[model samples]
Target: MELLAWGNTELDSSWSVTEKSNCSYIRIYHLTSGSICYSDTAMSCALDTEAVYILPSHAPFTMKPAPGTDTHCTWLHMNIYPVLVKELLSIPYTQKQALLFSLMRCIMEEAYPPAASLSHCAEIFIQDLYQMGCLEKPDPAFSPVLDYLCVHFSEDISISDTARQFGYTPEHFIRKFKKETGSTPYQFLTGYRMGKCCELLRKGYPVSSVCALTGYHDIKTFDRAFKKYHGRTASEYQKYFKKIYP
Candidate 1:
């Protein structure tokens, strides 16, 4: 999923919204107070209290905010870029909301211009919700396995092992993983490792230590992938880098 735009807004008593055309974006709303009616092609729900809503991309939606002395909700608009999660979701108060609140603070404060850090925070928040079994289960064909890959990216995982874990044959696993993620499992693992390397290196981890901790067998191979993926060496990034999660 790709984050397109995010911010917070409070609609007062006179709040209003109109029906619109097709939407290529998924909207997330956290009702801090008051209420609103949300409707789309696939589902319709009310943000009547302290609740969170995740609307699907490409599903047109209209908002009908309730009128009162004090009425408001905060919303986030994200472009899945390609639809990953398959349904609209409304999650009520839960422990996971604490994580969402933390991420919201990061998105609001740390993500001033909204770059990689913001994306990373948002992804983490959403993934938490998914793991909480709140959002509609993802595409059964590949979504669950993708989640497994994301959560366990740091572990020494193999395609054959993961495929078998997901009850798929090795041959079928390669095809499905490639088709859904646009990269083989190994390639995706490498990319995830590299992203983590960037994160750690930027955080002042020593080169040799980072290499070893990131599961790199040697600095040479690590350097190769780092330079190839980031177009710069790890040390270079540490000296002149901004936290961007890619």
Candidate 2:
């Protein structure tokens, strides 16, 4: 795991520029612009609107602003290795991926002010970030364990099964996983499932569907666990997100 830094810069008036990536990089650009051009191409896209674009590593790119233009945007640059990116894209793309990047961009923008620090907020954000992206390939043994939890998250997976897949004894696996992720396999799985349940409920999925999709054998068990982990009933959680996010 890497602690990446993020920041933004504003171009003065209108300008055209080119830059090189010292190492392979991936950039997510959130732009609000009247008009912009990339390289020699004229950008006829809508102006002064929200848009997102991806720039692959080491790709020479150019940007031009329309006359009398006033534009602003945030650029998130992750010095992602190719292997890591390939693994990240291995999973089916989901809106969660975009939201994860957006929140990260927000975090970098907000600068983690110490005065307003909140553990709950930090926990939720970090969990979402981990859930959104996959680790690079040839990762540590624990990396596969974590990835398995995420991909098979809807299944009733067990610590022993996770350990077996990684060719480690159950006891040894548990200790190493805890050391690396700061949570036991069971604890991590439960948290991951709970987070997915929240996402499903927010999308207005029915309780029965969320239960079935999240590997809960019964509605009673699902409701109980969801309430226990989130401190609210499923219905209450859905309503809460609607009000907060809408």
lDDT of each: 0.65, 0.54
Residue 176 of model 1, lDDT score: 80
TM-score of each: 0.47, 0.45
User: Where is model 1 more than 4 Å wrong at Cα?
Assistant: 13-21, 41-44, 84-87, 106-114, 132-246
RMSD of each: 10.7, 16.0
Stretches of candidate 2 off by over 4 Å are 1-141
Per-residue accuracy of model 2 over 1-246 as CA lDDT, tens digit each: 111223454655545645432223344455544555555232323323344454433334556665666766655444332122211112232465456545644554653422122223333433444565533233375566677778998887877877887898999988877566545566566766776776677568988999999989999999998887655788777776563333
Candidate 2 has an lDDT of 0.54
Native-to-model Cα distance after best TM-score fit, residue 132 in candidate 2, in Å: 21
> How well does candidate 2 score on lDDT at residue 171?
94
